[model samples]
Target chain A: MEKITSLADLKRIKEQVQSKIKLREQSASAEKLVQIRVGMATCGIASGAKETMSFLIEETEHQAIDAVITQTGCMGYCYAEPTVEVTLPGRQPVIFGHVNRERAREIIDRYIIKGELIDGMIPVNFKTIDE
Target chain B: MKTIADHILDIVQNSTRAGANLIEIIVVEDRKRNLYVVEIQDNGAGMSPEVLKQATNPFFTSRKTRKVGLGLSLLKQNAEQAGGGLQLFSAPGKGTTVQATFQFDHLDRPAPGDLAEVFLLAAIGHDKVRFCYRHTTGSGSFSIDTAELAETLGEVSLAVGEVRRAVAELIQNNLEAIGATR
Candidate 1:
């Protein structure tokens, strides 16, 4: 799939967000929950996102992490894909770059479980407008 | 090398790497003919002719981060080394098909890969994408269509624990039955 370039395109894409949110709501609950969002735009897939996502889900479930894994369309970070955004309950979200199975496990064990920051982070260079 | 199950997992992982949203994996073990065939089909943006020509070259990957793409090349080599052969067909917007056949008795033929886990992984990984996988041994066959399951389950996602377990168990039990015959 091609990139959704403009705000109009983003709006068109957001049209499906409601239904997707509904689907997600059926299971996802915030109880020390681990929320994993895989960057699933076409670029991510080309970069092996599917396999990475699968490995993460299997390993997380195998270890019985309180995780809810889901996919979101591009975040304009194609170069950083197959990217992953992890959010622990009551904590800020962190984005990780070039995620694979090995790194995924590390994230689960250290970051999710112990709240330690492992390497492989794509540094945040820009301060948010809100900040 | 691990079992054929591991190889299948690795290869199927490559299919997702190729941007395939729809993947169909078929495995057939024919005892009478003493042959085994595995086919992986995907509806993804396919390789261009130039890339297709060099797909087996190992050094000709389009990946910007990696120096080489070895997945398909390695799979092709493994198949050929085992007295079987590999065939790949692709078109730019159409999709790709990879088929490998092996003589069951060959020394290098790998053992059956962990297909059960493969389906489970796929069902969870690409819940939005559809995976239609079927396995047929000499005695019987097992098939799973995620699209069908999604339609049946209503708003519930396949990523849910119970659903993923059911799909995983279904593949495992069917595979166990097939293995029982031999």
Candidate 2:
């Protein structure tokens, strides 16, 4: 592709990105697509959330799964560094703790693809304002 | 938060959110001046003058999800605590540039942290946007542009597992070649 230099070109690309993200967002609220959020705080980074995130993003795409992966700040789960929250369509979001590349792949293959909930789940103990 | 790289990640997220397609991250270590400078320039929808005035205020935010924006404020505080400062230049409908400086050897200064991760995250998270990362340590310098990498890959997505691994290794190796260790 062409190198984005001018403001117009940048805006064009931004529109494309925004459209893709919009699809993901619409899917999240419409309960039509799987949504994944990887924690990327300082603690998460130190524990290798970057690798896990890359794995999920790539693996999901490679597997041809209709999932959107996004980054998030710390979830106050520092003890469970490298955490990931996965939300299947029409289901409650599940927070997975201590995720690595292997676990990321497993999440995609078993939990995400097959709807088989594996280990590394950090049980929700508190309620949110929306709740 | 704990490292300069973390601050960079936070600020760059702002750029991506601002609809930037090109984000440039420059790190310069000037031993002679005992200064470490990080500059993030983006061709995003810049802020209005009214918002620019309070971009560094912890109480200011443009997001509806929260009432306070602490990224720029925390970075400014970190730089100041290390005997340096942060500067933001932006214009409505133009773009934004954030320059943060820290004392090179200040005891309070945090390490640069994992920059390779930062680049990789930005690359994969914003696949459509292009990133240019340059690191300079008085000795030498190295720069990598995602657009150039994409040209080399020829239609391969950086989100691919092998490609992601290669990009991360390339960043690590290039930084090492230039003696930019964190």
Candidate 3:
């Protein structure tokens, strides 16, 4: 592959990748695909969020589950450093705390694939104004 | 915040958020000159002259989601506290480069923390974005480019556990080989 040297080249590649993602999204209902957000702030990274994120991504893909994994900054849960928020189709988003590689695998097998809630669920305590 | 690697990760996040598709992070340790440098360059939506002027001001921010943008300012503080300084260059359509240097053995300078983890996170989190990381010491240097890795991996995603582990190990091993690991 050619090295991306300039901003123009970078923008061109970004457009191509974005279009591919758009096509993928268009092919499937957004609500049907699982959405996962991993906390990756300084605190989260210090606590092994990167490892948790890698595990989640790999396990989900290995299981042939269609999902979108995104990295987000702190969710203000410093106590729970490696936090993960999972949003199933039409259900409310559920946040998990202290997620390690093992917890990640369990989340995938139970919560994600089987739609069964397991341990480590952090209850939604606050609400936005829209709520 | 606690280590140079932490600051690198924070600064790279700024680049990614600024619409950068390609980011380069370079760490050079010149023992003879007694300087340790961390430079991050990105082809992002570069800032305007006015914005660049205040880029290091903690109170100035372009994001509406937060009132204070302290990443750059804090990095500057960290560099200055360690007997070094920071320089930022940017143009509206060009790109941004942040270079920070510290005294090689400054007592206040924190070690580069968990760099392999930092590299792995950046590569896997922004799989579409190309990241090039270079670590140089007085003796030798090691560099990794994600684009090249992608070509080698064929269809495997870097987010895969095995891939991430391998990449991290590569980074750690190379850094150690060059006597740059902390």
Candidate 4:
């Protein structure tokens, strides 16, 4: 692909990608796709959440995994910042703490791809008031 | 904390949390003036005088999730240590603006870090909020508003993988053209 220099270039690329997205029906409904949420609050940023989030986005896209990667505020896990919450389709969200680039790779390989839970997952022990 | 980009990402998160729909991040690199400035202005729920007084206190945070709010405090310290200062302007219903200045050539100054990445992630994380990033150097300047980009792309979302990468490239290339460091 050519280097994006202006909005016109962006618009042209969007047309191409839109066609690809249409082919992937799984990517159509956001809930059915994988959801990766990275904590991006002050605590998470200080612990390098930006790199982890970038790695997650790049890794997933590179592997062609239909996933939604986003940023969230602190999950009250300031001690174990750079935390990531991954939710598979129709599954409960599981959070992993202290995520670096390497750890994020492991997440894509083990948990996301293979469906095998890994260590270092912050167990969701408490219930919210809504629950 | 470590880099001005990191602080920018963190501070922007605060803006989103404060209910801002439009957040503007401005970075100025002025070697001639010996100044590097990072300013984040938000159209969020603004702060009152009493709350603003304690905003820089490391131990004070408005959220119940944690006791300490080190975002502003850390930025303030980083600015002062680098021979500059931090200022905040806000009114109850007006909004908030955070501006921190540093001596551009100070030995204690932190690197700019990955500014393009910051813009990408900031836009991705807060999809509902529109972010505007303006970077200026002595040579030239570039500014991008997410709303405008979204309009240009029509219905395509910026978070799309290909679009996101393109957006990053757009920012990185523009910053380079303007002679921004890192």
Top DockQ: which candidate number? 4
Q: What is the TM-score of chain A in candidate 3?
A: 0.75
- Candidate lDDT scores, in order, read 0.68, 0.77, 0.78, 0.87
Residue pairs that clash (backbone atoms under 3 angstroms), model 1: B4-B113, B5-B112, B5-B113, B5-B114
Q: Where does model 2 exceed 4 Å of error?
A: A1-35, A39-68, A72-110, A116-131
User: Per-residue alpha-carbon lDDT of model 1 for A8-101, expressed as tens digits?
Assistant: 3333334444345344555557666788887654456567676787788778867867687766545556678788888789877788888877
Question: Tens digits of per-residue lDDT for model 3 on A51-74?
Answer: 787677778877867787877766
Using all chains and alpha carbons, the TM-scores for the candidates as numbered come to 0.68, 0.71, 0.74, 0.92
Ranking by lDDT: 4, 3, 2, 1
Residue ranges of candidate 3 with Cα displaced over 4 Å: A1-33, A41-68, A73-83, A89-131
> After superposition, which runs of candidate 4 have C-alpha atoms over 4 Å from their true positions?
A1-3, A23-26, A125-131
lDDT string for model 4 (B110-147, tens) is 99998888988898877889999999999998999999
- Of the two candidates 1 and 3, the one with more favorable lDDT, higher being better, is 3
Residue lDDT tens for model 3, B74-102: 88998999999999999987889999999
**Residue B90 C-alpha lDDT in model 1:** 89
Error of 3 at A55 (Å): 6.4
